[model samples]
Target: MNIKELQQYVSRFCDEKGFEGIPLETRVMYLISEIGELTDDLLEIKGATTEKQEVIKRNIGHEMFDVTWNIFDLANKLDIDLEAAFKEKMNINENREWKT
Candidate 1:
């Protein structure tokens, strides 16, 4: 599905399963925490920390998805319609590029 479809689908899934509780900021924090964990995994192999590389990589995928989902959630919450907005912005960019 496209971005808007996916946003609608996720919203439906969230509503159907009674999965509402945390605030947007909390989701953002979780996303940041995941990014930190992923970074730790990458850095640990270079003697930067003690976390395991393989384990951290696995968690990183989940965290990255968390980050993506929240971005979609925010988009949907604000009725921003990212799929169309992106297209609109790209058209402007295409018209403006190298126009000096």
Candidate 2:
């Protein structure tokens, strides 16, 4: 689904799960924690044997999704439209030059 849809879903989930009471600072902390988890999953997969990597790969997607969900939740809590923000950022990037 698109960013907007995903944000809406997370908002609804938070409301249903009583996570609406969570403060923005806590949300930011959670997002950071999820990022760490995702990084750990990536590192595990990278260093694992082929067979073990396959097992770790399965958990990697969930970690990635957790990161995305936390980001969307943070955006929602801050009342930011991630889809619009993303598009605006991309437009600015397209015209910008990068030093390689």
Candidate 3:
């Protein structure tokens, strides 16, 4: 689904699971925790054998999803329209010049 749909799904899921009352700061902490998990998965993959790397790769995807889900939930809590914000930011980036 698109960003808007994903945001709606997260909103509904949070409401259904009684997470709608969670504070923004707590949501940010959850997102940070997920990021740490994803980082751990990356580090594990780096040191893993080829066979073990495949397993860590799957866990990395799940961790990434968790990060994204928390972000969507945070945006919903903040009443931010991420889709519009993303488009606006991309437009600015598209027209900007890089020094490199």
Candidate 4:
């Protein structure tokens, strides 16, 4: 499904499960955790870092999805339209982007 559908799906999931919504701070924390996990996996796979960097790389895709889940969760909780949001913000990004 597309981003809009996925956002609705994740939001519905929380509602259907009788789950309380996560706070924005918690969602951000999860995002950071997922990024750290991805970084550790990359470092390990490249053999460019310490053994301490050897986090379980196999499940990073799941972690990434989980991060999106929380993001959509928080956005839906706050009644944000992510599609329009991104489209609106793209103007700023486009102007600031360097030519590849």
lDDT of 1 by residue, 1-100 (tens): 7877888876876678764555778767766776676676566556533456556667667767776777776666566888898899998998685735
* lDDT (Cα, tens digit) per residue for candidate 4, span 12-91: 89889965556778768877887787666665666544453344454556667877887787788788999889998897
Tell me which of candidates 2 and 4 scores higher on lDDT: 2
On residues 1-100, what C-alpha lDDT tens digit does candidate 2 reach at each position? 8888999999999999999889989988998998898788887787789999888888888888998998888888889999999999999999999889
Local distance difference test values of all predictions, in order:
0.70, 0.90, 0.94, 0.75
- Pairs with backbone N, CA or C atoms under 3 Å apart (clashes), candidate 3: none
Q: Which ten contiguous residues of candidate 1 have the minimum total lDDT?
A: 45-54
Which of the predicted structures, 1 or 3, would earn the higher TM-score when compared with the native?
3
Where model 4 places Cα greater than 4 Å from the true spot, the runs are 48-58, 97-100
lDDT for 84 (candidate 2): 99
Better of 1 and 2 by TM-score: 2
- lDDT of model 4 at position 46: 65
Alpha-carbon deviation at 27 in model 1, angstroms: 4.2
Q: Give per-model CA RMSD.
A: 4.7, 1.1, 1.1, 4.4
For each candidate in turn, the TM-score is 0.59, 0.92, 0.94, 0.69
Per-residue lDDT value at 65 in model 3: 94
